[model samples]
Target: MYRAGGTVTGERDAQPGVSRVRRLGTHLPPVARAPGEARAFVADALRSWHVPEDKACDIVLAASELVTNAFEHGSGGIALRMRFTGDCLLLEVRDSDPGDPVLHRPGPRSVRGRGLALIQALSSAWGHRRGGDGKWVWAEFQLA
Candidate 1:
């Protein structure tokens, strides 16, 4: 059993042209459907934020890939978080696996091992870090 939580907080200063930040997060069961669930969660959030469809699709795809990797390789629990600061959108997936994800350059006939590469191609930047409980893989997209 897992719970979902979200928080949105931001203020516009007198300097002008600053965007408010919005955030959402959830913990997901480590199951085969986790990737699909993650994609739905992200797509809903982006839609509510009025993110463009094309960009939203890319973000959702990235989230799916991260969640899939976590479900396949991680242990214990999995968590997902998203942040939108107007010009940028950030997606983070945390799992109980301490090992960092690797990006492999697969050969032409390779049947798998392209998730990280797809994420890199779709996102402006992506990385991972070890946490107290596990590790978090994050991706950032610059929105126009």
Candidate 2:
């Protein structure tokens, strides 16, 4: 006997019903503006994805880190995207940077770096990806 555990019940029989929407949302834009733009973008996206307003802070934090990393360390052009995976929201920021990102070693006096550490602490999971082109850094947190 397993419980449903925060899952939205769908149709059990042959009737068509609204299943949980594992919706995917993507955003890409020129970062020629300000810092708050990233926060605004993520907030609007979370609202669209039915994420409660109260939980916006955590999502915003994760989104900020991803976007900041892309803009700070990655290439010139950037894109921000997100999706719903199970009960969590996955956020991604892609760039054309050729540099591979690595998590800074955690130490008591560490101050020069810790972004990845922060993500790992606050988010459910996060990492980066490189393909034939460039790379993308991402993070995920519970949608609730």
List of clashing residue pairs for candidate 1:
none
RMSD from true fold, candidate 2: 9.3
Whole-model lDDT, candidate 1? 0.84
TM-score of 2: 0.68
Residue-level lDDT of model 1, residues 11-122, one tens digit each, is 3434467443377787888888888878878887788788999999999999999999999999766788888888899899999888879999999999999999999999
Kindly give the stretch of ten consecutive residues in candidate 1 with the minimal lDDT sum. 1-10
Maximum-lDDT candidate: 1
- TM-score of every prediction relative to native: 0.85, 0.68
What tens-digit string does per-residue lDDT give for candidate 2 at 17-81? Answer: 84443443344444644235667766765665578776677778767666667667755656666
Off by over 4 Å in 1: 1-21
| C-alpha lDDT values of all predictions | 0.84, 0.64
